[model samples]
Target: MRAIAPQPLLDLANVSKMFGGVSALSDVSIRIPEGRIVGVIGPNGAGKTTLFNVVTGAFRASSGAVTFADEPITHWPSYRIARAGIARTFQNIRLFASMTVFEHLLVAQPHQGAGIRRFLPARRADPEAWRRAEEALAFFGLAAYRDRIAASLPYGIQRKVEMARALTARPRLLLLDEPVAGMNHDEAAELRTLLRQLQDRGLTILSIEHDMAFVMTLCEMLYVLDFGVLIAEGSPAEIRSNPVVIDAYLGSEA
Candidate 1:
């Protein structure tokens, strides 16, 4: 008999959430492998973002389990989850409008010193964090714009800065919600290449996106959600071919 491979880097087991009488997710389960980009796609109000929130601990699930690195972390707080090696971006860009691009990266740097004492910056300390921040700026091709105010940049650049801030966390699992939501085709393609580079550096990305073509190039696998249930799961080609997925998402195309 052949042996099965190891478990996924992240797993959701029978997970669910509800608001009043409405269930956002119902008994959903998914497994994400290491070093692979997974894309989530669905129509509006399909519980895509709700699933991300549940995994990142922005909200507690009404039932079921979420596991990272094989350890359960369903109810942990958002900050705790971040420290636990999970980091995420918003469906809408959320950045400190008044802060400079450099400051944004600095703030997301990991806390090196211990406790409250760490809050106060020493006259001289940890050059490592600063190095990482600068490296992040260059990684996103924003080293030239590092001094600019974040909000002052164009929308496309703001998106790049938002992603750079998330990278500053150096997360094991990067969750992106519509990172290319509002962009011209050229800009979106550029962002896709950046994400591919990040994944090549060993970032595990789980993204929610509407641009089917964009997702086709980025994701190694795809999961479809509709009315809070997982309707399909497969490679990009398989997802494109699945009739039910087409029916649920592309009505006439199905």
Candidate 2:
């Protein structure tokens, strides 16, 4: 008897994106297995961010399909896609400067109900939302910073606050864009630990990062893109040795 293949948590089949005459992605395909960390790496203008935008519904693909949890989400609006359990952080920190860390988390919580109930002012604090927010703060080691203004924290701590906010959405899959972009070595190491903790908690992640060391160590598998095309996909070790990747992205580092 043949074994059945496990369905991917997210799958992109022959996806293509174009901005007028210029192609940002062409025939790109990838599968993110459930509960795994997958990395996408490329040089500047390699279309990594374009792929993310297409998947998250920020831009509809010019052609091909995007499916999440076995459902086709090709034409869904950005808000609908987010509501369907996909959450992401931007390449740049997107925290509300004036808001407290705790407040940021609170605002990210998905509200229950619809119509009048949704629009009506809450008469009381939402216990569930508060509980989730507190848990996220503690999990990310930001409990003490809960009342601190987001802009006043250190850069590393601000990144954690942004991640904590994403977590409050209770997503099954997390998308991170340059998550450790501005961190020092120690901060990056701390973030690596936090990412593993999140993975262990059953959250699957798809990340696009320029930090080669971080991604190579954290990701189970990787996809390499160049000029809107997927040139390779494999384990970190395999990718590190691929001559095409070395030439296009890694350069002398390889």
Candidate 3:
């Protein structure tokens, strides 16, 4: 079978967000093609996370607009955005400590309503969804501990589990917020491999990360934001040589 061509999956146009007297983002426009990974990079306080929050509706943009899959979704609620196939992981891990990993995946299936819910999980449980969930866990090699509580996993595997939960929801656009924040080099490398595997399988990813090596390897296009505005954008190699990006990230002494 022939593979389908990738298309524009998520688009942001002149999106700006503010909190009280602070302007977190200004006139930021970005287009993410399907099946590609785009990196969002910046110095501290560049509003990277703020942009994610705005897109996912954690906070409404004070000005400008946002759209997903061609429809206007500027200020939709978070759950609404999730239902629309926008799944995100936090900069810090957020998982139910006491819940088993399988339970986490099951709950993410959404309300199939009473008719579908009552005898559904018992009667084959939508083989496709189960297959996808199992596939994701197997990809991350977490199938062995499907019944384990989330908090009991090792840190590196915990990252995999969190990512697994996100994939279990089957999002079209996955917003990964520093998937390697607290990880060591080896752990980070593993996460990078998982992300690439996700992209190769036709997932569109927008990630916020500080690890330059990870960013350069995973993303073809890089968007740089500084002090609430996008200062530069280009290919990873170009971004590495960009003066504006250097000024934003490194001091002139370099």
Assess the local accuracy of residue 148 in candidate 2 as a C-alpha lDDT between 0 and 100.
89
Candidate 2 has its poorest 10 consecutive residues by lDDT at: 115-124
Candidate 3 local lDDT, 1-254, one digit each (tens)? 64475436788888888788888998999889888899999888899999999989988988887888877889788888888889988887888878887767766666444455546563275666667767777776888889899778887777778888888888888999987788888877877887888888888999999888788888989999999999999999998899878877845322
Steric clash count of candidate 2:
0
Enumerate clash totals for all models, in the order shown. 0, 0, 0
- Cα lDDT, all candidates: 0.87, 0.89, 0.83
Residues 157-245, model 1: lDDT tens digits:
88888888988978999999987888889888888888888898998999999888888888989999999999999999998988898
Q: Which stretches of candidate 2 lie over 4 Å from their true place?
A: 1-3, 119-125, 252-254
* Number of the predicted model whose lDDT against the real structure is largest: 2
Better of 1 and 2 by lDDT: 2
Measured by TM-score, how close is model 1 to the native structure?
A: 0.93
Model 1's lDDT to the true fold? 0.87
Cα misplacement distance, residue 238 of candidate 3 (Å):
1.2
How would you order the candidates by lDDT, starting with the best? 2, 1, 3
* TM-scores of the models, in the order given: 0.93, 0.92, 0.88
